[model samples]
Target chain A: MSKKRDDIIDTTSDLLERQGYFATGLNQIVEESGAPKGSLYYYFPGGKDEICEEAIRRSGASLEKSIDRAMSEADTAAEGIAALVEGISRAMEASNFGAGGPLTTVATETAGQNERLNNACEEIYESWRATFERYIRKDGIDSIRAERLSTLVLATMEGAIILSRTYKSTEPLQRAGAELRELLEFAR
Target chain B: MSKKRDDIIDTTSDLLERQGYFATGLNQIVEESGAPKGSLYYYFPGGKDEICEEAIRRSGASLEKSIDRAMSEADTAAEGIAALVEGISRAMEASNFGAGGPLTTVATETAGQNERLNNACEEIYESWRATFERYIRKDGIDSIRAERLSTLVLATMEGAIILSRTYKSTEPLQRAGAELRELLEFAR
Candidate 1:
């Protein structure tokens, strides 16, 4: 991607992460990215929706890579999940308690309102679930149960983010991580 | 509540649930509620902030009532959770996959941005967690673990709402319900 194009995505992702799709304005994206209106339109003709779709995809892939790195670092699935929990807690604390990443807030906001954006979120979530299922499966859980458990894990993380952000504390995410690890280990 | 006051809240709650804090307009609330512009200002002198704060509190209380009713109907904590999950699934299906409720989207959207709304969301979550902890304790779980598990349950439910809404399916929620029930039962 061109530097300007990349800047647009990077800036838009941050804004979307902090605010839902409807709350983010195009002018703000241009101002934050330092990209001219003409340049933004040149890269993303469909404008805000287009930019958001790409941002969600980019963030989703980036998150999956992070997950892979986190999961690979640990000797076991349970430990890997714990590492992720800790990582998320640290990140949330760093942000001063922001729930739902760029992908999440935008995903929920556009779920029923925008098909293109909603599909992007759905694809991202499915990819994340697949990643979790792969890790859980290594622990000897069957494929079907692993799939279901992966969904639960994802839900828990997402929900915990919301709570942690709302309370402006990491306790909810930390608590969720420990409980989820226990549940996953017990499943095995 | 007076009929006009109730109308204002109901409309604001629906808008906030669908659109979050920044996206929900005061004019939209008045138009949707049919409470007249004068009546709205008369009731909520602080405009959108006041209306949103009240809406969050009202929705929070309403959700607690629903949860209490669901918990009361079931024979076990696990069963109670399943009932709540089923109810949420049906409601999401009815709304064509809107995640969470009035409380969730607003809570997340306003987290850290607006102290008043954030506090309202936090209080609501705390009350819900207390309710869940009470039920978990009834199942012979200790208080400390029960508190943690309650947070986990709330996180899972909130996260599952996001997924279910994104995929436009109730499968995520249904799967979470089963997994959570298993985990809760195992903790006993």
Candidate 2:
């Protein structure tokens, strides 16, 4: 990605999290990214949908990497998971809770309404779930259990972020992370 | 709610699920409900936000009732929960998976943007969680664990519905239900 394209994706991710796919406009993206008006069309011939698709994909990947970093440096998968959860909490603060899971709002807003965005969101979620599943497996959980565990973990994180942001309290996320970590042997 | 009010609520729910709060306009609600333009103002002084709040609360109450019904009829809280999960799957299909969860989307969309709607959704979620927590406690799970379990169930349902609707497949919901059942048990 060009520096300009990267900035466009970065800024769009912010807008998508803060608002939603429908509410975030090209004008806003240009205003935030400092990308020229024509540049949006030049880079993304497919328009907002295309830009959102790329932004959402990067959001998932970046989240995956963050979680990966948190886990890899931990003493165990359990701590890694804790770090991952805390990482999200920090992100919630960084975005002033204005920014949430990118695909969540898009998934809810456009799932049945727009097939293209829906598919993009679906891909993003599946990829995130898969990333979590890999970590769950790496944690030594059984395969059957890992998949389910990963699903729950992802769902919990997604839900917690919303609740924590909505209530302006981290209680939900804190409780959720504690519960999940307790499931692992690493809980002290 | 009056007959016309229910019609508007139902229509708004469908629109909110498929299109979202921002994308679904009062014009569409008026057109879909066949309610007069003046009627919306009468029912909701706050317009769309009020309508969305009412719809979300109604949907939340409906879901809580399902949980109560399932628990009351079940031999144990476990089966009650299982039945509730199954009930959600059927309900999603009944709604054509057009829109997933009302509270989830409403929370994400308006939580930060709209304070009144945000508080209403917070209360809705808290009420549902309290109800679920009540039964989970009755089922013998401890207090803290029960709350966490309820949160997990809500998240999984929300996530599964989004995935199911996107893929037009109920498999995620079903799979999520089974996993949820496990979490409920595992929480103990």
Candidate 3:
């Protein structure tokens, strides 16, 4: 992608994470990204949906890598998962509870209302879940059990992010991480 | 509340659930509710935030009652939670994946940007969590464990609702429900 295009997508990703799709106007993206106004449509011919779809995909892949890195740094699946949650908690606090759940608000907002954006969100969430599944499977878990456990972990983390953000406290994420660690250890 | 006021709040609740705070315009709420447009500001002197806050509280209380009813009907806390999740799954399917998680979109959309709405969301979520904590405690579990487990249950359900809506599939909620039942049983 061109530098301006990348800037636009990057800005969109951050705006979407903090304010969601409808609330994050293209003008704001241009203003924050310092991309020329005309360049937006020139680069993303489909307008806001296209820009948001790209942002969601980019954010999703970025978070997947973070999950992978967190998983790799720890000694075991349980510890890795706990560390990942801790990292998310810290990020949430750092952003003043505006940073986490990049796809959550968009997913919920557009689920039935906008088919294309909904599809993009579904794809990203599936990719994240698969990343978690891959990590869980490394613990010698059967495929079925791993799949279910990964889904639970993703769901819990996603939910915890919302709660943590709303309460302006990392306690929810911290509590979730502890519970997930216990569950993962038990599963092993 | 007058019938017109109730109608406005009810319409706002449904609109917020499906489309979120920013996307659900005041004009749409007036048109859909069929209440006199002038009456909106009369009933809710504070305008959109006031309307949305009332809607969130109403929806939250309604869901809490559903939880209480589900718990009352089942013999075990595990069974009741499973049933509650199942009901939420059916509701999602019934609405064509647009109805579940009434507070999720609004909560996420307004989390950091709107203090009044954010506090409304925090209050409702806390109320729901307390309800879950109560039922979990009734299972003879200790307070600390019940608190943690209830938070997990709430988070998992909230996340599953998002996934199920995005995928247009009920499997995520069902899987979360099954896993939650097992976890609750294990705890007991």
Q: For each of the candidates, what fraction of the native contacts does it recover?
A: 0.83, 0.47, 0.69
On DockQ, the candidate that comes out on top is 3
lDDT tens readout by residue for model 2, A117-172: 88877787788778777777886778877777776667667777778878877778
- Clash-forming residue pairs, model 3: none
- Once fitted onto the true fold, the runs of candidate 3 whose alpha carbons sit more than 4 angstroms away are none
The C-alpha stretches of model 1 lying farther than 4 A from their native spots are none
User: TM-scores for chain A, candidates in order?
Assistant: 0.97, 0.90, 0.96
Question: Where does the lowest 10-residue lDDT sum fall in candidate 2 chain B?
Answer: B179-188
How do all the candidates rank in terms of DockQ, highest first?
3, 1, 2
The best candidate by lDDT is: 3
lDDT of 3 by residue, A22-78 (tens): 888988998999999899999999999999999999988889999999998887789
lDDT of 1 at A186: 81
Model 1 lDDT, full chain set: 0.86
What lDDT does model 3 reach?
Answer: 0.88
Candidate 2 chain A: minimum summed lDDT over ten consecutive residues — where? A179-188
- Interface RMSD per candidate (angstroms): 1.2, 1.8, 0.8
Clashing residue pairs, backbone N/CA/C < 3 A, model 2: none
Query: What's the lDDT for all of these models?
Result: 0.86, 0.77, 0.88
- For A78-137, candidate 1 gives per-residue lDDT tens digits of 888999988888888887776358877877677778889988989999999899899999
